[model samples]
Target chain A: MQKMMQQVVCTVDVVLLTLQDSALKVALLKRGRAPFKDVQALPGGYIHPDTDADTRDAALRMLAQKTAIQPPYLEQLATFSGPARDPRGWSISVVYYALVPFDVIGQAGQADVTLASVDKLPRLSFDHRAIVNTAVQRLRGKSQYSSLPCYLAGEAFTLPQLQRIYEALMGEALNKVSFRRKMVEMDMLEAIAGEFSAAGAHRPAQLYRLKPELRDQLTLIARGL
Target chain B: MQKMMQQVVCTVDVVLLTLQDSALKVALLKRGRAPFKDVQALPGGYIHPDTDADTRDAALRMLAQKTAIQPPYLEQLATFSGPARDPRGWSISVVYYALVPFDVIGQAGQADVTLASVDKLPRLSFDHRAIVNTAVQRLRGKSQYSSLPCYLAGEAFTLPQLQRIYEALMGEALNKVSFRRKMVEMDMLEAIAGEFSAAGAHRPAQLYRLKPELRDQLTLIARGL
Candidate 1:
């Protein structure tokens, strides 16, 4: 006698994050079908056989398939499963979050894309608003103790630029002296011995690069740190 | 003309947490059929109309159906969707974490059910182990800033008992004075207005209960504050 076996279905969704015009933006693709036809949503799809690749790889693949942007950083965000979430049938979705440098994503200028502030956004399809809220909250909370904000920046940037990113995401201005002091204490930044003087700025501010070793260490520590 | 539709499968897996033997434990159920037949895994099932009321409801329903544990606290954890994650086809699973008070799950023992720890665990089916790991990490991290740990304790508990739960989840010993100070500062605890004596212990310590109103406020503040 064979035991009764139940078949389950799975899919992947992504919350793509990038900065535009000094505002944090999330990528939302317009769905073209019923249930949520023509509604804006995070880019995602069925996990393909090729999805055997690492989790990030799967997210990147799905993003690329749906949109023209290739994100640099991707992390597992959270999963959403409810019987009626999808009108089709029993479906569970593992949601991943991708953080791309604003410049990289903006270069594409995809017509269907729109950059919106995290606070004010359009109605999303299928509990995506909740997923994005959770991801943003996690990103903000983790950025306080980790170098996550750096992931949103390019390879090299001025301290002030980095500070602005943190301030924007945190929605508060941090005291310059105190913020830099804390960063120095963390030992996650390496002075680049260079300065940025683009766009006729007042003074050339000192630049720093995230230490690769420290970044990796922080990733491990961020789990429990 | 009808729009091209994409069909994908979804599922819901749950990490039901309970306190047993003064340690954190998770509920695992045995699979009755292949892909990892007879192996223990988190209680979950396909999200179907007859089976699951909705995506969020699936986890709770699965828990009740499989383990008969209706946990009070259930939150969506993450979604896992990788093409090859399932042998059958492309699948995505929305994983949920449920914090069941020790007393609520104690009833499961009456039904001859077992809850296991991460250390002494049986073989689990599929990416369920990875799902459990992610849930545990999130629980540990959130417990620090939220009153989640209190949910695992009895209605009333000693400060030391509460602290031990934190240490066990975090796998680290916190400074007693500092920990107590932080808890008091949060104003999330209230002395039971009396003291209780313990057997084979030094001195009787005052018991405290989580202030419900304060805890709800803290949850909000922790998200934005």
Candidate 2:
């Protein structure tokens, strides 16, 4: 029975996301060859059986090859599979979403990489549109009560900067006092003592970074704002 | 080049969970054949390419055939893969977890089924122990803010009965007043008017059921208690 069955194609797709121009953007790569020749698609590749040990590793490999960046936060989004999902054969794709810092995007992400705002996404190849949508919901839903947004703010960030990033992702203005209270309640950030920068105001704002314990992982808040 | 690659084995495993004797339990079936022959394993089987159109279908088929019960709540848990995960080459198993009511367990589940307490689980076959652990964490984590617990409470239940189920899974004594407050906040259940029953107390306990809109599906609570 094993020898007679058709092999199911396994692949990994990354919904690489970052904040660009104060908007949440997902990186898309141009296909090198057909079936979707020249079409922009999510960064993806076949999992190399010889080289990759796990699906997560395969996702990392694809991201590294395409973007040359090891994102600070990555999580398996979902597995999308069906006979009709692919043109060649029945295939399964374990989709992952990675958060990249905005400043790092210009220095890396090789040619053919294009960051498209999730709100106004171009028609993506394969079942990628559905995949991207699912990843967005996960990000937004988890962001309400998790230390996930920090991945977009980079290593050193101020409370105001962090609050801005959250606002951009959720597309809403938040009350400054209440937001600060929530950050305190989450206990996910630690103030970087003697580290302050005056961006526009005369008085400098205190810089803070994610606590080591919560870094690169999700820590659920007690409740949503 | 594609033909030269090794074929990945695809299978689906179901962590059919139920509440038994006021404790959480998961269904484990004895494997009849090798490589981990006769070992207690989650109900699983190879995904039939011809008959199964999708991974979820394969999971449901495997569960129904083995358990003789069409589970009320089913969700794709995660996809586990690797070379060493199975003795038979490279394989990927799309794991799904199902919730069944306690009363329905005796009517179905057939022979060869062993309901093991999730807290006091025995050593399972293959990478099953890890799979079970991930599933339990998901169930417990999601339980805090979702209507997921209703799947174990049967079709119609009292608020007190529902609170007891939540308390059992959470391993804590919940304050009745606060629990009712949280239940109202969730908006997933509706009181069944004129359907009060005297189970033990002389005062009748009002019957409540999952709102028609939320039956057999997880409804996210506004906040976790």
- Residue-level lDDT of model 2, residues B1-225, one tens digit each, is 464234577788999999987888999988899878888999998877667888889888998899887888899898898888998767788899999898888888397788998888887887998998899999888888888988999878888889899988777888999888888888888888889877875677889888887765677878686
What would the per-residue lDDT of candidate 2 be over residues A5-81, giving only the tens digit for each residue? 35577888999999987888899988889878888899888877677888899899998988898888999888888
TM-score of each: 0.82, 0.96
Q: What's candidate 1's DockQ score?
A: 0.30
**What CAPRI class is candidate 1?**
acceptable
DockQ of each: 0.30, 0.53
Alpha carbon lDDT of each predicted model: 0.71, 0.85
User: Alpha carbon lDDT of residue B163, candidate 2?
Assistant: 89
Q: Point to the candidate with the largest TM-score.
A: 2
Candidate 2 deviant stretches above 4 angstroms: A3-5, B1-5
Angstrom error at residue A185, model 1: 3.4
